[model samples]
Target: MSQQPKSSDDENQTEMYIRVKRNKTTYFLQCLPSEKVLQIKEKLQVLIDEPVNNQRLILIQTGEVLDDSKSLADQKVENDAAVALTLRKADNEFEDVNVVKPDDYIRDGDGGSNW
Candidate 1:
């Protein structure tokens, strides 16, 4: 009987461990090497407080941002890979409530202090 050659997928489907560093915390996750980055992000959303959309996962070894369309295998994310997590700032988040500006010093055309 003839046997078919094994595909790379077969070789890469093995489960692996990935470490995530976020917010001064380290999280360890078990996952398949072939799992999509989106899937990993979904899981991360569950484990971490941040939403997936706001989270940026960086493969520490490769220094590449994990894309939603690519799989860990495609990124060559090996077993025990370390991923760094960065949170995307929302438009309103962390805004300076009282920012000083040069314009603030200038008075309006109206002499009455346009406070």
Candidate 2:
């Protein structure tokens, strides 16, 4: 009697690929079969310069912000998962405020208004 061949599932397991987009650049993250979303975020922190806690990352498909407490496995992150980094606007109002001193308006050799 001949023996049956093993199924492909038994021979090899497929790995999930996570895609991260930062500053318009796309990064591919190859995760283990059991890796969590938080684990992936940790890896991303190393790749980007921004602080991990302050940085905003969203799921491309759902446009939902990734909760730090959640896991990638829980989110059902699978092959071709697209993750995007959203930059937060600076809170300071002075960022665009320009201050011009009175001296800046003085003309060459022009004295103050003569009475």
Candidate 3:
């Protein structure tokens, strides 16, 4: 089917495509320049199952991370811009105490074991 060409005014009003890359996957996200960085992360979370807090979007050309407090327009992000996706590591400092050993338990006067 043939489609009519969009007018310049219509084109200006339409959302632009932002290419997102993660490993070998590429996602073309429709974004408005006025949208906040956090909004973009929220969109990515729904599309790719990436947690919003864990996502780190970097500009492919400049390697600059998108600031959560700024709008896309503030960064001068234009249409058809490419972004690389990275994930923040989970909290590895948490000690897993699920498997308690005998040595980990101390006996009190009442003969009760305490962790």
Best-matching candidate per TM-score = 1
Clash pairs, model 1 backbone: none
Pick the winner on TM-score between candidates 2 and 3.
3
Kindly indicate the candidate among 2 and 3 with the higher lDDT. 3
Q: Per-residue lDDT for 112 in model 1? A: 48
- Candidate with better lDDT, 1 vs 2: 1
- Model 1, clash count? 0
TM-score of 1: 0.67
Q: What tens digits encode model 1's per-residue C-alpha lDDT throughout 16-111?
A: 999887644778889987788888889989987677787778887777888988988889888998888777776734322222344656676766
Ranking by lDDT, best first? 1, 3, 2
Residue pairs clashing, model 2? 37-72
- Please rank every candidate by TM-score, starting with the best: 1, 3, 2
Residue-wise C-alpha lDDT for candidate 2, range 1-115, written one tens digit per residue: 9956868643433567877876436778877545656677677778876556546567777877777667665665557877776654576211221223356566766674431
Put down candidate 3 lDDT per residue, 8-113, tens digits, no spaces.
Answer: 6555445788988766577889988878889999999999896888788878778788898897878877899988777765662322212233554556674654
By summed lDDT, which 10 consecutive residues of candidate 1 come out lowest?
A: 92-101
**Candidate 3: clashing residue pairs, number:** 0
Off by over 4 Å in 3: 1-14, 91-115
Q: Which stretches of candidate 1 lie over 4 Å from their true place?
A: 1-10, 92-115
